[model samples]
Every structure is written in structure tokens, then in C-alpha cells.
Target: MDVDARLRELGLELPTPMTPAGNYVPAATVGDLVYLSGAGPLRPDGSMVVGKVGDGGLDLDAAREAARLTGLQLLAALRAEIGDLGRVRRVARIFGMVNCAPGFNRTPAVIDGCSDLMVEVLGDAGRGARSAVGMAELPFDIAVEIEAVVQVST
Candidate 1:
């Protein structure tokens, strides 16, 4: 299915691409690989989902949702950089980081939120290698952050 159709079927709409909060660009391409910088769970309303996971902060469910939101942001960046999601050849790799309190161990499950969306949107092309780990803190204290490497048509 077309990416737009798939998004509609999933009841999702892409948010506008976010401007960089620092000096770095949001995405860059070299050869056929598009590297997306780390993105947090910033919503369209400009509010971010902020909290650590585990202990006295957000729970796993909330963190998972945040991961999903971060994935959406990555998609927005991808669309902005390439002009077409259809040009994507494969989601090559993803690196996920979760801001959490001590003893949190469900990083992979939380990051799955992003992985699931990619697969839903791009089918087999979205399946990719991934690493999810815990962080003491993240930018804005957002529950999750993710960066991706996507291979696209040259």
C-alpha cells in the first residue's frame, strides 16, 4: 500500500518535521543511506512527553507511546529529506535510548513501539537491526529517543 494510505489505515498522520534544537541537521545522506538524528517524543502541539521510565516516573506503557511518537518524528524527517517515503529502500538500523531510573530493563520492549510502526508502514523494508538501551537522562527528559539509518533510492 502507499505510505499515505497505510498511515490513514493506521489512524496516524505525520507531524511537521521538527527543526533542529542544536547545530546539527535533522537528517543527512551519504550514498544511499539517510541518517536521521535522534528525535524525541515531541508532539505536534510542541509539548514533549517528559519523564524517566521506571521508579517514580512514567511507566512502560507511557514510555512505549513516547517511543512511537519519536518514530513518527523520524518519519517526518525522512519525508522532509527525501520528499517521498516510497523512495525508501529499507530501514537499515535503529538505535533507541530510553531515559529511565535505576533498574529498568525493558528497553527493547519500549523501543518496539517504533519498530512496530515502521513495519506497519513499510512492510518488509521496515524490518531492521536495532539496539535499545537505557540512559540516565535524555534531552528534555523525554521518555524515549530514537535515531535511524534508512536506505533510499539514489
Candidate 2:
């Protein structure tokens, strides 16, 4: 599909790709699969969404938005690595982590923000295996962090 066109159709634009927080590269490719490192919710200006997400903390809806933003960052990294989103043949997997208050159990629901965006952008090719879990903390205290694996056509 025309991935760049699809983002505009959704009224979304990719932010500048983020640099790695540490010594790791943002993406690595082996054969046709590109593995993305975790990405946080970085705003267009580069500030991050930081907080614990859950009851009496950051609102779930806001956390979901953070996840979506994180997803956008992942896409940015993916495109940077692969040259074009059209190179993606399938979204193979995702690992999502949410920094949350104690006892929050809706990790999957919150991560759907990213999942939904993938499906919206790539249709069925974006449907992929996923795991979402709550965490006590994440790098920079970001509300959500997501990593992805995508299969691309050579």
C-alpha cells in the first residue's frame, strides 16, 4: 500500500526519528525482517509523555494516546531503517510496555492505540502477534514504550 499517503489520509505526520537512548541502534535488519527497538511517546518538539498510567494517575485515554504516539515513533524508525514504509510486507510482532500505577490490568486495551493505528495504516498486513504488559518504570518515565518486528519485501 501507499504508506505515506495513508498517513496523510489519517491526518498524521511522522515526527523526526529519535536517536537511541543508549548504545543500541533504533533498528536492525536480518534478511527481510526489521526489528525495531523500543520507542517512547515523543512529541513533535521532542518532549516525551512521562508519567505512570492508570487509575488516579495519568488517564487511560491519555496513556492510550501516548501509546499511539509511541507507535508513530516506531514507524518513523522503521521508515528510517527501511527507506520506505511500502517496503513492509507485514507487521510480524509487537512488544508493548506501559508504565502504570499499581494494579492496572488493562495493558492490552491501552496498547490497542498502537495496534489500531497499525491496522488503519496497513490494513491486514498490520495485524500481528503482540504482547502488552504493565511496568513499574520505563526509560525516561515515558508512559508507554513499544517495539516492533516487520517483514519486508526484498
Candidate 3:
């Protein structure tokens, strides 16, 4: 199936590409690799979804949703840059961050939301190594943020 079809099958719609919050571009390509800057959860209407996971300020479930949303946002960035998902060969790695309580230990599970969706959309090729970490806080109080590297057709 095509990328659009897979996305629809998973009931996800990509949000519009967000402008970089700082001086760097959202993504850049080097050879066959596309490196994406960390993306915070963005609602479909362009507003940010703000809350910290396990902070009592946000629930775990919501954080997972935020991660899933972040994945979609990354895909949107990929599409905007490359013009198509078919150009993607494989997702190489992802780094996920969740703002959390000092003792919270569910970082890996929260990041699974993004990992699972990548596999759902791109099948086996999407499977990749990942690191999930907890932070005292994240920019804009976002629940989750993620960045990725993928191999793409030249």
C-alpha cells in the first residue's frame, strides 16, 4: 500500500509542517539520509499540544498520544521535504524525549507510540533502534518530542 493509504488505514492525518522554532531547518538531507529535528506534538489545527508526561500535569496515555502525533508530524516534514514517502527506504533510528516526574519510568512505553506507528505505516522497513528518555521539562511543556533519521532514495 502507498504511504497515504497506510496513514489512512491507521486513522492518522498529518498535520501541516511546522516552522522550526529556532535557527535550524526542520530537516536536512545528506546523501541518502534525511535527518529530522526533534518535533513536538502539534495538533491538526496548528496549535501545540502542551503538557509534561508523568508530571501530574499530564497523563501517560496523553503522552503516548502526543508521541504518536509527533510521529505523524515527522512524516509530514518528510513529505514536505522529499515530496513522497515512497522515496523512503527505511527509518534508521529515532530519539524520543518525554518530560516527566523525577521518578517516572515509563519513557520507553511512551516512545513506543511512535515506533509502533512507523511500523504500521511502513511495515518491517520502519523498524529501527530508538532511545526514550525522560527530561525535567521540554520546550513549550510538550508531552513528547521525537527526531528521526531515515534512508531515502536519491
Candidate 4:
């Protein structure tokens, strides 16, 4: 599929890639695999969707949107690193983290936001193994964060 065209078809615009907040690079390519660092719910205008999930924090829907936005952030970084997303062979795996109130266990449902977008954008190549976990807090208290590993044509 033409990934750029797909984004336009979906009316989804990728955010500008953010600089690494710490010491590490946003993505690293080892051979044909591109390992994406964790990205938060950073928006196109340089703001973040920050809050906890469940309970006294964001509702499930809001948190899910946060995950979707984070997915966009990761995509932006991936494109910046690789120059063309068309080179992607498949999305290998996803690691999603949700900042939540105490005892929130519906993490997977929230992270499905990002996962679903992957399938929507990349089709079969976007379906991949994934893990979703809850965290007491995340950097900047962003609602969701996601990291991915992708296999690409060399």
C-alpha cells in the first residue's frame, strides 16, 4: 500500500518528530530492523495529551485517543529515520504503556488505539505481537506511550 496516500485517505496527519527527551536517539536501525524508542502523546502543535487513565484521570476513550496520537508520533520518527515508510516490510512488535490510576487493569483495551491504527495504515504488515502495561506515571504524565520494532526491506 502507499503509506502516505493511506494517511491522507484516513485524514490522519503525522506530528512533527520530537527530539529525544533524554540521552538516547529516537530510533536505531540494526540491520533491516528499525527499533523505535517509546513515544508519548505528543501533538502536531508541540503539546502533549497528559493525564492518567481510568478512575480520576482520563476516561478509556480519552486515553485510547492518546495512544492513537502516540502512534502518530512514532510514525513520524520512523519516517524521519528511514526517509520512506514504504520500505517497511512489517511491524514486528509493539510495547505500549499507559499511565493510570491505581488498580486500573484495562490497559490492553486502551492500547488497542495504536494497534488498530497500525492495522488501518499498514494492513497485514501492521499486525504484530504486542504488550500493554499500566504505569503509575510516565514521562510528563502523558496518557500513553508506545514503542515499535519494524522489519524493512534493505
Candidate 5:
């Protein structure tokens, strides 16, 4: 299926790409590899979803949702850079970070939210190497953050 069709089938619409909060660009391409800057769960209105997994009333499910949102933001950046999701040959690597309370160790499960969405939207091309790590804290105290590398057709 085409990228737009797949997104419609999943009932998802890409948000506008966000401007970088700092000096870095949202995405940069080197040859066929596109590296996306770390993204957080920012709503369209620009408010962030903030919390720590396993603490302050947040839980696994919430963190997973946050990860999914971060993934969407990454996609938004990719689209902004390449202008066509169809040009993506494969998702290459993803690094996920989850802000967690002490003793929490379910980072992988949370990051699966992002991984599953990528596969759902792009099929096998979305499968990739990944790492999920826990963070004591994150910018904005967001529940999760993710960065991605994608291989695109030249």
C-alpha cells in the first residue's frame, strides 16, 4: 500500500513538522541515510506530554502512548525533509529513551509503541535495529523520546 493509504487505514494523519527547539535541525540527510533529531510527545498545540514512567501516577501504558507520539513526530520530520514517505527504503535504527522512576525497567515495552507503529505504517521496510534505554529524566520531563535513522531511495 502507498504511504498515504496506509496512514489512512491506520486512522492517522501526520502532524506538521515541528521546528527544532534548539540549534539543531529536525532532520539531516547524509547520502541515503536520514537522521531524525530526538522527538518528544508534543501535541499539535505545542504542549508536551510530561511525566515519568512508574511514578507520579504515570504507568507503562501512558509511557507507551508517549513513545508512539514521539514516533509520529519523527515521521513528521522525515516527511518534512524528504517530502515523500514513499522514498523511504527502510527504517534503519531507532534509539528510544524513557524517563522513569527509580526501579523501572520496562523501557523496551514502551519503545515497542514506536516500533509497532512504524511497521504498521510501512510494513517490513519499517523494521529496524533499535535500542530502548531508561533515563532518570528528560527534557520537559516527558515520558518518552525517540530518534530514528531511515534509509531512503536515492
Candidate 6:
């Protein structure tokens, strides 16, 4: 099946591509690779999803959900730029930042939120190396932020 159909099968909907909030583009292409800038968890209504992982405000489970949402938004941005998700050749990497309490131990699990979605949509080929780090704070104080490198069709 195609990308749209894959998403439909998974009951996922892409959010509107969010404009960069600062001095950066949402995504850029260098050769055939698209580098997506960090995308914070954004609600369907276009509001930031705020929290810190492992804190009472946002635990591991909540952070995972946020990462998943951010991944979908990233794909939405990709489709907005390329006009079709099928143009993606493969996912190269993902950088995940999770705002969390000092002792948070589930960074990998939180990042799985995004990873699982990529696997679902792009299968094994979409899997990529990932970095999941805990930070004292993140842009907009959202639970998670995701950036990616994707190889695209010519």
C-alpha cells in the first residue's frame, strides 16, 4: 500500500504543518536528504503539548504519546514539502529530546513512540538510529521534540 493508505490503516491523520517559531526552517533538503528541524508536540488545535517526562506533570507514558504525535506532525511536514510521502526513500535518523526530571529512566521507551510509528508507516526500512536525551527543558516545555533525516526520491 501507499503512504496515505498506510496511515489510514493505522488510523493516523497528519496535522497541519507548523511554521517555525524562530530563526529556522521547518525542513530543508540537501541533495536527496531532507533534514527536519525539531518539532515539538503540538495539539490538533495548533497548541503546544507541554510537560516534562518522569515528572508528575508528564511521565514516561505521556512522553511516549507526545513523541508519537510529534512524529505524525513531522510526516505531515514532509508531505507538505514533497507533495507525497511515497517520495521518501528511507529514514536516516531521528533526534528525540525529552524534557524530564533528573532521574528519568525511560527515554528510550518515550522515543519508541516515534520509532514505532515510523516502522508502522515505512516498515523496517524506516527504522533509524535515534538519540533520546533528557533535558531540563525543551522548546515550549513540551514533553518531546523530534527531528529527522530522511532520504528522498529524486
- Score each candidate by Cα lDDT: 0.93, 0.92, 0.89, 0.91, 0.91, 0.87
Ranking by lDDT: 1, 2, 4, 5, 3, 6
- What is the per-residue lDDT of model 1 for residues 43-123, given as tens digits with 9 covering 90 to 100? 778899999899878998888899999999999999999988988899999999999899999999999999998999999
Cα distance off (Å), candidate 2, residue 93: 0.4
* Ten-residue stretch with the least lDDT total in model 6: 46-55
**Per-prediction RMSD in angstroms?**
0.9, 0.8, 1.2, 0.9, 1.0, 1.1
Candidate number of the best lDDT: 1
Show model 4 residue runs off by greater than 4 Å.
Answer: none
**TM per candidate:** 0.97, 0.97, 0.95, 0.97, 0.96, 0.95
Query: How displaced is residue 95 in candidate 4, in Å?
Result: 0.3
* lDDT tens per residue, model 4, 34-92: 99999998766788999889777699999888899888988899999998888889999
After the best TM-score superposition of candidate 2, give how far the Cα of residue 20 lies from its true spot, in angstroms: 0.5
Residue 135's lDDT within candidate 2 is 95
lDDT of 2 by residue, 29-145 (tens): 999999999999998877899999875668889989898999899999999999989988999999999999899989998899999999998889999999999999998888999
lDDT of 3 by residue, 51-104 (tens): 767668778788888888899989999999898897889999999999888889
| Model 2, runs deviating above 4 Å | none
In candidate 2, how many Å is residue 87 off?
1.3
Report residue 16 deviation for candidate 4 (angstroms). 0.8
Record all residue pairs in model 3 with backbone atoms less than 3 Å apart, i.e. clashing: none
Note the residue pairs that clash in candidate 2. none
